[model samples]
Target: MTSDRARLREENEALRHQVATLRQELTCLEEQMSFLVNLCVASHRLHETADRRELLGILREILNNIVGSEELGIFELDAKRSVLSLVDSMGIDPAGFQSIALGAGVIGHTALTGKTFIAGDGAAPTGTGLEPGLTACIPLRCFGGDVWGVIAIFGMLPQKPALKPQDRELFALLERQAGLVLAMTRPD
Candidate 1:
């Protein structure tokens, strides 16, 4: 009878160890999930910028965080004239990006299609005058069915050949937030 009791105690101790290990793993997973959630929330908050100046800063941060890129530009579309006006941006030489026209480069293509474009090549199409590099562009559109701007991201090295599903998802999230802010601030 005493041997059976000892065996039962050992089994209970083993079960306790297993439970403890599982609890630790669960805690670690929860922490990871919490981190990802905070990133998404912070990304959304970036659009809270009150003016173009603030928005430009926020845009740079978002691209750096999400796309892992340091060089980026934001171009506003003048739909009436078919021109892409260089608005607020970061990590680029102004003299290199003046009066960049719509449909002139990857950003132009995104504006024209209202779809995101990703390029792995380090070359902007001929005649666009953009510096060669891997780039991605997301069209900016606001409520009431109006296209407002474009988000352009460039990297020193060639990017992956295709946009991953996660990349598209992030761009979509930024697009929605940017549209809301642009619509709110634009002349009504």
Candidate 2:
């Protein structure tokens, strides 16, 4: 049997080593968690902004930054008719496509279902009248759960890796921001 003093010293050393290992792991996890939290906070700030045009611009920037897509749009919903009309957009010409109907095409399906749809299977283009590739339509809801609009994102050539979960998430973020911005700008 070992002496009591030696046994205690060994046990103490083992415990100290364990604590140090735990501390290192905790520090690493904390740093990772901090990064994730910062991402969420930044996204929220972008979504909750009150400036309409600024919010649209920021939405475009965020979508472009995250998904690296060149074509994006925000289509306003005609509540009475439940149609989506072009309010603003980027990378696509809006002058000829405004007043397009919702629930009449792909954008309509995405807005009506309130979900994301993949369009890479040679699916024909929808309301925007643009050529379609891998496109994502995100529902935009305004105050009191009113469906205000949608942020439609598309690419002409198929994206490598096709579609991704991150792409959907980024589209959703763009949708939320677009709704907030549209509400502030549209006439009451």
Candidate 3:
């Protein structure tokens, strides 16, 4: 009878451990779902913006509230001049990055190659023009495989010290959706 009680106690403990693990997994899933929903909302807001200023504000909102970053710059590519001209920026000096040549720094490299660059990933080449604390550079590509601009993301919030899988997903969403929105709204 004593052995039976010990076995039952062990089973109860195992079941309790399993329940705790399952609860943790559920919590993680909920967080991811919330992030995805926010991404969708941000995309919708970008599409609904009527002008460049509104678009910039929406971009700022996404970076600040979603990505947890406040330092960002949006540079439009001028193919005729082969230069990236800053369209809007925050938390960084605009004069220093007013016009970046194609393939010059992180912004230029992304504009030239249509490749996203993330700092500390060991993928950015030396002198890539990544600012002192910047973390990611994403090429804004419109439909038909054309890159129209670049979004330079500086430091993440202290709470978000490093990039996560969700952050990468958000970047991808911005790369695709933000480009389309900008292309549609850009003046001819």
Candidate 4:
């Protein structure tokens, strides 16, 4: 009887472990689902309007409400000189970053390479602007993968501590979809 009881206890423990693992996986799936929903909503809002100001407003909302960044700038690339000029920003003055040359700093390099540069991910050379608090530079690329601009996030909201995996997904969504709206709404 004791041996049978021991076997049952071992089995119970194994079952519990499996249950715990499954629970963790379920939580991850739920999180992913929520992220997807948010991305869809953001994309829809971005394309819902053809007005440049309205699109910019939606972009800011995504950066602030979803990505948790309060200080950010939308830069337009001047490809002739390989420069990125700040078009709009919130929560911080953007005078210093009005123009940034490609490969000159984090933001410029992110635009040039069409890569997202998150601070602390690596030793990214910082020099263009918004130093001491520059958090991320996300290159906004259209379907062809040509980077047309950049989203420079200088600071995040107080409630959030750091960027998460979901934030990266959102950045990617913005990189792919956000640029299209601007391109479509381009002025003649």
Per-residue lDDT for 102-159 in model 1, tens only? 6776677677777776675355444365646636788877886466888887663245
If scored against the real structure, what TM-score would every candidate get? Answer: 0.68, 0.65, 0.94, 0.84
Q: Model 2 — which ten-residue stretch has the worst lDDT?
A: 125-134
Candidate 4 clash pair list = none
Order of candidates by lDDT, top first?
4, 3, 1, 2
Question: How high is the CA lDDT of each candidate model?
Answer: 0.70, 0.68, 0.87, 0.87
lDDT of 3 by residue, 1-188 (tens): 99999999999999999999999999999998899799889888988867978998999889888888888899989989999998888888888888999889777888999988888777675564446776899999888979999999987889988878788888998898888888787888
Question: Could you tell me the TM-score of candidate 2?
Answer: 0.65
Candidate 2 lDDT over residue span 70-140, tens digit each: 78777888868777788777778777557656566778766676665666545544544453543777788
Per-residue lDDT, model 4, residue 6, is 100
Instruction: Point out where model 4 deviates above 4 Å.
Output: 1-18
* lDDT, candidate 4, 1-188, per-residue tens: 99999999999999999999999999999988988999889989998999999899889998999989889999988888888888789987877888888888888888888888988897887675455588888888875888879999988888997999889988888899898788787777
- Each candidate's root-mean-square deviation in Å? 5.9, 6.7, 1.5, 2.4
